[model samples]
Target: MRLITYRHDGRIGTGILQNDQVRPFVGEPAMTQVIEQGIGEVADQGIPLADIQLLAPLRPTSIRDFVAFEEHVEGVRRSIDGATGVPEAWYDAPAFYFTNPHAIYGPDDDVPFPAASVARDFELEVAAIAGPDRTIFGYTIFNDWSARDLQSREMTINLGPAKGKDFASSLGPWIVTADELSPYEKDGFLDLWCSASVNGTEVGRDLLSNMGWTFEAMLAHAARDSVVRPGDVLGSGTVGNGGCLAELWGRNGRQAPPPLTDGDVVTLTVEGIGSLTNRIISGPEHGPAVPARRRDPARARHERQH
Candidate 1:
């Protein structure tokens, strides 16, 4: 079943989407509650999908995004640093980073271009929603909006993508439950076709099967020495073959396509999971900038040695 959180008649609620209609849960249960328990009871008849606004399927408890596609890593490395080969350590285990769960936006929402960046881009990916017993609840399209310029600077310092990434992320039209996608599963990976487009122009497409690591393995790595609760989200990262402009630029020897600008629309589609679309808008005004302090070279060297 496809599940969604929608707002209708100025009220927000969780529902099951069936043939353009939404069968809302009897009580306005939180999505986390619905994920933990089952979709208990629902209104027999349905509300027209057109009457409601879809919200981000759920407010994720946490988000763990992984670089599961080797080609994507190679492409990004080439784009950023002109590196040609994948690092040997990448093959040893899954690698991921935690992104801001609070910055989530739903389908059709407007994402702001980060004020500090000029090279804004979008990443086409699939996200697995965790359920009870370490199983997956469902899947949704995830657009990891990036501020390439900020990310580039931060990575050179070997520290962040934090401010570069934390501004916004888009998820959902709805979540397609695991059972609905079971037929497409092959050897722990889904053989699903995923694609992305900008302002109606197709830019990239690839198979989910191209991922170097499986969601189960990534999730296992996440769980090591820690707890993974239901409602946690695991992203499959960007798919190869033009999943993001950075990858495309890397593959084409650093010749980049235009970065996402104000009013640009980005849409990502996964074969079974439906499409997620969002528009870019100007970022909010900033207050004041904090300048970084320059340390004395000798003091810095002494501190590093210690």
Candidate 2:
């Protein structure tokens, strides 16, 4: 079952994606309710998916994405000051953050333009959506669009990714149930293939099996010293040797500049997942912008009212 939180009729609700429509889940304002009840239990509610507006499934109270891909990690390290080593803590610690949940968009949605962004790029990732009181329930494809130039400038402060990563992160049209992806549940190798095209030109391609840290490890690490509740999303970082410009350093690894410009259309496809297509707009009206705003207060009230 592909779970989704969508919007319609000026409201947000949880629903199951079947075919081209949504099947509304009953008596649950949030997906965490369904997850805690178990998918089977939620299914028993039997509300026709046709009814209800699908919001972002559930508004995550917090989100923490980690850099779990080994190839990307090593590649990034080596590219940074010729450093090839990752911190020992990095191996043991699952780094994460509170991403802007409201910033998420659906399939085929246009990624909003960011003012600080000059070289926009796409990151292919897999996100784990927590279920049942913070238990991880399912996985979905994620596209973390990046502004390479801004990210580089921000990193010099050694603060953290911050606005560098928060510009816009895209979620799915559907969330694949954990049961379906069970083969990848126990540290077993799961093939990951990521391909990106900009304005019909190929830019990046890579596999998931190449990740340095497995999903299980990432999950465990996220749970350490912190409780990951249901509806939380854990993102697998970009693929190794597969970044847009940060890793490429103005070259496509083929001796050509790889900078993204306005109007560039980026499409990222992850194996076993779906494709996320976004267009690079010019820039935001505001300069040195903050992260995109969350849901309108009025919208939140309306959801509860329904």
Indicate which candidate wins on TM-score: 1
RMSD for all candidates, in order, please. 2.9, 10.5
**How well is each residue in 140-178 modelled by candidate 1, as lDDT tens digits?**
999999988878877887775788799998989888999
Could you give candidate 2's per-residue lDDT for residues 1-306 as a string of tens digits? 678776656666676776666666665456666666666323333344455433344556666777876666665555433566566766766565566766776666667757656666677777878776445688777777776666666778876666656767777756788776666543564675777777887766877777666666677777777787776888877766554445565223332346567777777776666666767665557745466777799989999999
* TM-score for candidate 2, residues paired by index: 0.77
Over the full model, what C-alpha lDDT does candidate 2 score relative to the true structure? 0.66
Candidate 1 to native Cα RMSD, angstroms: 2.9
State the displacement of the C-alpha of residue 97, model 2, in Å, after optimal TM-score superposition: 4.2
For model 1, the stretches where C-alpha displacement exceeds 4 angstroms are 296-306
lDDT at 172, model 1: 98
